[model samples]
Target: MRRKDSHDGPARGQGGGTGGSGVTAVTGGGETGGVTAATLPVFLFPSELLFFSEQRRCHRRVLTLYNPYSFTLDYKMLCTSPSLYRVLEAEGSVRAKSCVDLVVRHLNVSPANCGRRDRFRLEVRGGGQRGGREVWAELRGGEEGGGEGEEEEERKRRKPGGHQQRGLQLPLVPTAVRPSVSQWLLCVLLALLCAAVLMLPLHTDSGSMVPRCLHVSTNQKLACAYTLGLLTMVFLR
Candidate 1:
């Protein structure tokens, strides 16, 4: 007796576009979809910078400078902190339409200084070029989980606006990680499986290769060794 509704599910166009795609949107409504999820900024570039005197002593790196102008160009290398890392042969001249390699070296650092972080800058100036090209570098003595892009951006923003700035750095101490419940459960299961295999009926012909500790009448040492070995193997896994 009643007329059938034209719509199949929830009605559309009831709510305006400002709030969300529709009231039907289960989650991530409106501009939330456009927003980027925040993530850690890192010094993502890979470079050789480590302190291992016994293995590979002083760290060495090279930077190539090119002069495209018709006249000769003068290049100079500068460091933010000279103590952290040094510029080996900093001063040089590059001929017109030519390039030269700038070599830099790491100083003798004690193992006590391991796991420390430092940074430096090398600015190259030339009369022929309109502006100096700057190269930013960092020294990492040990494995540290971190990134530098976000902090640098924040520093730049605060510098222009004259605000009190806070330094960003990686934690010197590594965060401790605890084993999860699933991992412990998996380890228990593996130990039980190993025990079951070792405790099977010794009389079976299939297990002849297994140590005959239980059957031996005179010696118990072999049996003790077998048991100890089984436990050691389980723990190792």
Candidate 2:
């Protein structure tokens, strides 16, 4: 059987660039003047091939094939995705070479092979927002996608919250300290101290009943106690 190999240069910045490892300068002109789309760098797989051979196992027909570039065991089956088989049938054996060739060129290297039955792991990487910072994503092989692809799809499905812009990160919890019972306790303790100081000065001078210090009036003593208590609370807080 034959294989029709193909790859779509993923949508620009889709999955954050997983096609090629080089920077591509996108230039354009507008009313303002000529402009560049900045340096867009990405990693990609070029030409590749998958070959399936028919054999008999336990008196039953079986097709055995493996893509060295595949990232999952589920797609390791020789005839996994039925749609791809149709493409192979359409292109025939000879044309499949072009498909494989494209992936190789995109990846910036000649492809490698470790026997026809060996599984493959293909990945593309590119620099992200900052210069020379690279991000990698494994390429999905066969007609079906793999684990990484499913995760990517899930990300696309999620919508950003109100504070988060389309491409921006969402803020977590806010910075303000939460209100709690300790603050209330501090206020209550300060009030009790003020009441005690206000009543202390009213009692007659006596060794056991009167305060031993300066005989300030009830209001003054209460005000002083309130001030000191407030200061202590502020410092502790």
Candidate 3:
């Protein structure tokens, strides 16, 4: 009801500056708002995505997002070539100070696409902020091309630092073939049969009263031994 307040606009402006723009500010009045806007920087483990085109028909890799902030963070993944890749849970929220794994699958895995390069963008938003941060990572479709020397250099370049956060390494190809239970049982049976054949009497003494039909010839024993040896070798292999 009194004179117009000339300081009203300036006071509102100052409040906006401290509350909206000063994301890192720690003022008593705007501490919560500042923290919400200034979210802890999210990190991506491995920093790069690699797919083996020549190894399998489909390639899948995991990309991890670590949210170190005390508040929850919303993240969305964007790819340069969406048709060739599929990201599971491309848009989701990670809890405060927690990590989330994104399963990225390469749909078009072929020798022709080897060495192809792509880019991925992670947009993280928190604290009800309008605009958020963007993190970029590189994606390679296939194994590095070059000789052993070049491959060594590439390996050195991708080595993680001591302080860097790393995730578990996943195998690109299936594991080695292992013998099944049935195969083991078969091998054991063959071993027992071989032993029994070797224990048979190759010749019957003239003084013995054993039936002549029961006598095993030397040639028969040799043949059995040879056959069992071959079978053992095959199963062992």
Candidate 4:
């Protein structure tokens, strides 16, 4: 198993720590977990930044900011809140703390109203894994509340160095994806097959063709020939 350097937070040195080595303080009336409080760096599109324009447009009532980095989004909430979705879809990065505040104010929503609301507080503490490299990536939200202390310790025990594995383990079996070359070849073969099928009748004559002044092959003979040609081409490929 390979080990990576862990990220403590902005306050900690850029790189250099071993397994589960960060302190995050949680002070809200909500449940606490193992995530450490840290500032996450994110790139944002200009459209997302317009979330701050609450005072200017749509009155002080509507303020939108699109986080290029997504949060734990509730699809149901999103469907209900089109404006919020629009802000998130526009794109840009802001402090997670600020985002939480914006969410509270803009949606007039309390944590109780949002699904997995407390989990979005990953911004409050650097709860997820970060690597030594300054690369950007997405993290799946873990369960909210409970098992955090045990999980963190388990994570630490697994790694002597502070770096934790930085991704989610998908629950479902992954669909098999065809190799790119195979996919391309299949597309080409299909296209050729379609073209051959289309042209088959034109190249062969049917008994009906002679009566209509149409010079064309019968569908059955054309199909056979097309099949043979296609098989030959496939074998060659």
Error of 1 at 161 (Å): 62
Over 4 Å off in model 1, which ranges? Answer: 1-58, 115-117, 127-130, 141-237
lDDT by residue (tens digit), candidate 2, 1-237: 322334332111122121222223212221121111334221213213433121111111112122233221111111122222211111111121122221111121112311222212222212222111111112222322332344555676674554334655888987766546897688677777666666664535555455467455666785767677775665576
| Model 4 CA deviation exceeding 4 Å by range | 1-171, 176-178, 202-237
- Taken over the whole model, the C-alpha lDDT of each candidate is 0.43, 0.31, 0.56, 0.32
lDDT of 3 by residue, 179-214 (tens): 899987887787777667666665755654666666
**How well does candidate 2 score on lDDT at residue 232?**
66
Candidate that would win on TM-score: 3
TM-score (all chains, Cα) for each model: 0.33, 0.19, 0.40, 0.16
* Model 1 worst lDDT window (10 residues): 21-30
Full ranking by TM-score = 3, 1, 2, 4
* Residue 193 miss distance in model 4 (angstroms): 2.1
State the lDDT of candidate 1 residue by residue for 29-127, as single tens digits: 112212122221111112333433333333555555555555554434444445555544455445555555545566655566555544333333445
Q: Give per-residue CA lDDT, model 4, range 106-204, as digits (tens).
A: 333333333322221222113352211011111112322332444666768677566665465669988755458876687677657655555544443
Best by lDDT: 3
lDDT order, best first, reads 3, 1, 4, 2
Candidate 4 clash total? 23
Model 2 Cα displacement at 155 (Å)?
26
